[model samples]
Target chain A: MKEKEQMKNKTGYIMLLIVLGLYGILYFVHAGKTLQALEATFGVFKTVAPILLVVFFLMAFLNTFIDEKSVAKHLGDDSGFKGWFIALFGGVLSHGPGYIWYPMLQELRKKGALDGLIVAFLYARSIKLPWLPLMISYFGLTFTVVLTFYVLVGAFVQGIFAGKIMNEAKKDR
Target chain B: MPRNVQRLKETSLQTFKTLQSIAPMLFAVMGLVGIFETFVTPEMIHKIFNAHAIHDMLLATTAGAVSVGQPFLSYIIGGELLDEGISMYAVTAFILSFVTLGIIQIPLEFSIFGARFTIVRNLLSFLFAIVIAYMTTLSTSFLSGYFS
Candidate 1:
């Protein structure tokens, strides 16, 4: 397992090198655009920094305080309706770049969280509480409410699909 | 050391390790995202939709999947498209996918979650974006008529 993880890290380094190589080539061909891209990259890092900090802190808290058995009880295979509800609402309440949550989700998965609940959480992020007012202003109350409702339902449906397929795949592996 | 302090130290070390493990992929993802965002503009997305309902929805969903942004930004873009006479189906799919899908972050997600899980989750999300968009449009219209 450690060897496999090391190999994955190596692949990530290779990918980073390839991106840097492309930027190096682009610098000569389109210096301005390459510079703009670099700036955007910095902006992304800046935006994600605080989110990453919070996520890491949460991970640490979970690691220190929360046991695997507890995680399994709440979000594992048999967690049922309550687990799904937590994931769906948790996704809605989560704020920031969705990618930032990947590591936290990974931690949960390691602790026995269900794939379906993870999918539910990710899909349910579509209904942003902070943006509902803005969405309503542009699309009106009916449209906003209906769209949000569908997104929640769609999330649940997709979660079920993910759970079934992922569990089967796990069994096969 | 006290028990609580020992736990705190362990937590900090664990956090650091996790950060170290994910750093390379995270940086690579950010680099790719920056390049994609710098090159792809909202106007470029706008030009892709031709106002054909089904065709536009597919294109919009594809566009949204490839591109990433905040939900608020998607709403603004969706509203602009709607005003420009794009079908509600197209705009809705675009908005839904824009938030739910992240093609740029695939590498990071793949590295963290493994290939099968990442692929399945993303595929499901992609399909659901279109389905929900269709449902949202139909339901919204019905609700609007009922309320009016």
Candidate 2:
């Protein structure tokens, strides 16, 4: 696991180095364009820095308070409406990179959490709480609100479809 | 230390770690975005998206599905795309699929979930992203008009 994490970090570093290297080469070939790109990059970082700080802090808070066991506990097969609620909101509140949650979700499925709810959880993750402010800042409140509403609706719809399809496949098997 | 204080400390440490881990990719994305801003013209983007709602949504969905990133990064990219005169439909679809549909994570998802489940979920997400994009933009415009 540690090796895998190290590999991931290495990949990120390599990608950064490549981008930086591109800029370095561009500096000799097209210094003006390279400077312009650097300025644009700085502009983007400046625009996002405050919001990113809030997002990071919120992520940390969520991490400290919400443990995987508790999330898993509510997503069981018989969890019903409450399970759906937990799945939807839990997805919104989920932090960190999405891949990290996959293993825990896989474990949850093994323990009998419905595939529908799992699908819902994954879909609802698109509506991230930490990033809501940033989204609102870009897209405005109305667009953000409407988009979030539809995303939750889409989550449930997709969840139902996945659940039904998986069940039918199981029966056929 | 008190329990609240201990929690705060842990949270702060986690925040630092997350920021550290994400920094490299974040800078890389920013640099790429800078290059995109400097070189990628509106004419180039328009050629791909073309402002026709359906066409833009489809292209946006395709672009977003193949792209991988954190949700926050999508907002930045989406915002920039919007600044470049990409339609709201395209940007919306792009943002949705960028987070929800992970073509890159297919192997991981397949290994964890069965093939049927992974395929079904991704296909559904891809379609729904377009639907939600249209719904979101239409609803926002309507609400804006009503309020005004």
lDDT of 1 by residue, A1-173 (tens): 89978987898898899889888988899899989999999998998999899998899888888889999999997899999999999999998888899888989999999999999999998888988899999999998888888888888989999999987987897
Evaluate all candidate structures by whole-model CA lDDT and list the values in order. Answer: 0.89, 0.77
lDDT of 1 by residue, B40-122 (tens): 88899899988889999999899999986567878888899999999999999999999988888888888888899889988
Each candidate structure's TM-score, on Cα atoms with residue i matched to residue i, is 0.96, 0.64
| Candidate 2 TM-score, true structure as reference | 0.64
Model 2 spans with C-alpha error above 4 angstroms: A1-74, B1-47
TM-score of candidate 2 chain B vs. the reference? 0.66
Candidate 1 chain A TM is 0.94
- Per-candidate clashes come to 0, 0
